[model samples]
Target: MERQLIAALAALALVAGCASPQPAPVQLVDQQQYTKAMRDNSSTFTWPESRKPDLAVLAEKSGPGRDRAPSGSERIVLEITNSCACYLGWEDARKRGDQAAASQALKVMDEVLPKFSPEDPDGQRYARETAAKAKAGDGSQAADYVANNCDSVLWK
Candidate 1:
């Protein structure tokens, strides 16, 4: 009975190890390496094709007031973060060879990027350059740009 119980526990452990996904690598040295790592382990995680966040509604729903409405500046920050999320998703999908997912992410990015307020020059530039790369079928530089510049807004 003791031997049987031990064997059963070992079998359960083996099954669990096989079923659980390995964690994504934490420290890639550069964008090219990062992209390679993501592609190699794309099956380890679910890459959701996210929608553009509606800033008006999001701002109205958050912040420090009874009305919970954020300031104009705060709203622009929200827009940048949300847009970057979509951008990252697009690049990630492209790396994974997932055309359908990449297209979905790009669609969201197109809708969100245009709405960035004129006050944000960096946001405008990122939108322009990344969108161009995405459409031009050269996503490597776009991914590198995002890694270098938009690291703050990148998803954890």
Candidate 2:
């Protein structure tokens, strides 16, 4: 009986150890209430209600020399990440040769490239050349193109 009891306790210990832990409870706050709280607080800056999502509020708050030209670096980074994801997906679409998937990825890159800023002459030229190369089936040129020109023109 003692042995059976010991075995049962051991089994209970094992079962307890195997159980998954519970997640913490999340607290949800409404936007207006949060905004009101922020406004009421002396430490925080109160934002106007008319401020939209796309407004450069953070940049504005950064003060002088913050309102520079809109560079496409962020867009370029997003595009490059998307392109890499598409390329990996395309690779899995066929056994030996998936020309269709490759073509689809190329089309996506082409569509996204034109949306980049042409304000920076060097970046613009590099972007155009890279897009042309990509269209011509030399997609590998993109990494080199980005590395050479993206930091100089896209980023601040």
Candidate 3:
């Protein structure tokens, strides 16, 4: 009886251990990673080489006295490209059951969109609304936003 009791308790402990929830994976999305992801989506956009964002300058904008943020059509291209990448990351995370990654992508969007707001309010508004829709699990709006906005650039 003593041996049987010990075995049962050990089995119960093992089962409990297996049933515990594992911590979700860490998926931090920094600016460089985000920038690369944005560039990856650039195939969906049409912009002149001069207008494409310089990754080094983009990485520095978060720091003080960094006035290198793009303006005019360049700024618009950056906004549309980042928004396209972010929306895709958000939806992919949702599909993969990685809420942390989705939220991180949105956080990156929040960090990026404001820098463009002063120069291009309309583009910022569109990107902001797309992020909000992603937070609400409405990915179709993001798709629509990217499709309708990205391809129409005149690339001057």
Of the candidates shown, which would achieve the greatest TM-score relative to the real structure?
A: 1
Better of 1 and 2 by lDDT: 1
Q: For candidate 1, write residues 1-156 as lDDT tens digits.
A: 122322343344455556669733222123233223333433332334453333333332222223211112243335544555666778778778999988887766555575466645776776777777777887775567556545433233
lDDT of 2 by residue, 1-156 (tens): 112322343344445545638533222223333233322331222111221112132222211221221122223223333333433333333334767765665554556444544434665565566567766756566756444433322111
**TM-score on alpha carbons, each prediction:** 0.46, 0.34, 0.44
By the TM-score metric, which is better: model 1 or model 2? Answer: 1
Number of clashing residue pairs, candidate 1: 0
Q: Which residue window of length 10 is worst by lDDT in model 1?
A: 63-72
Compose the digit string of candidate 3's lDDT tens values, residues 88-153: 566667778887877787776666654554645776776677667666767777778657654432
Candidate 1's TM-score reads 0.46
Candidate 3, residue 18: Cα displacement in angstroms equals 70
TM-score of 3: 0.44
